[model samples]
Target: MLYFEDLTPGRRFETASHTLTQDEIISFARQFDPQPFHTDPEAAKTSVFDGLAASGWHTSSLTMRLITASELKNVANGLIGMGIKDMRWPQPTRVGDTLRATIEVLAQKASGSKPGFGVVQLRWTTLNQHDEIAMQLETSIWVARRPTEQA
Candidate 1:
């Protein structure tokens, strides 16, 4: 199982590849984000995005799946997401585009009072098959450390 010690600063972790499908994008958007650029291709084309796109939340969900598949479930601290910073949906992700992501360990430190736990900060970016960045976000997770008694 992963613990706070496993997240060394500067270390990088990657997510396995997955493809974005048209139907998946439409279905996800229809249920949650219903934006013109996400639900219909034609409407998307004229809607400033130039083509059908996945919702930003959908991209985030894909990131979650990738992270889970990458063995990150080891720590599963039920991550208390404090909040995200400077979140921007740069380029739109199109259907049939495959994506993968990398998470860089930006920082890790002890919690103010939670003696048995710490926090890890990371910034991740998802890239399409063409190596184009489709989404990026900063995040943090609370992690329990190996008991000091064990150390």
Candidate 2:
């Protein structure tokens, strides 16, 4: 299991790709963000996206899934989010788009008050098959520190 001491600034990780399909996009949008552009392909043709688009929330969810199920899952403790900042969905996620994510450890610092944990700042970039950024965000996570061995 990876501990806080194992992480450093500039560390990077990549996740496997997942192809978004029309059915899943429509289903997810129907349940959560039922915008016409996301749920109806016909209506979407006239929308700003010009095609069916996945919800930003859906893209975020997929990003989380890729991260958790990737190499980052080796952390001593499961990924526990502390906070998020500067989240942006720059481009629409269209149907049949293959999505992948890359994570960069932007910074890390031991917690002053919480002795057994540290805060890690990470930047997640989710890109489509065309290498266009579909969504991106910076998040802080709590990582467990390595236990000190007694002499």
lDDT for residue 90 in candidate 2, whole number 0-100: 97
Q: Residue-wise lDDT of candidate 2 within 1-151, one digit each (tens)?
A: 8889888999999999999999999999999999999999999999999888999999999999999899999999889999999999999998899999999999999999999999999999999999999999999999999999999
- The lDDT of each candidate is 0.85, 0.95
In Å, residue 64's CA in model 2 sits off its true spot by 0.5
In candidate 2 the C-alpha lDDT for residue 120 amounts to: 93
Off by over 4 Å in 1: 76-78
lDDT accuracy of residue 6 in candidate 1: 89
lDDT tens string, model 1, 15-130? 89999889999999999999889998889989877889899899888987898788676774755676788776788888998989888888999888988889999888888899
Candidate 1 C-alpha error for residue 130, in Å:
1.3
Off by over 4 Å in 2: none
The deviation in Å at residue 143 for candidate 1 is 0.6
TM-score of each: 0.92, 0.97
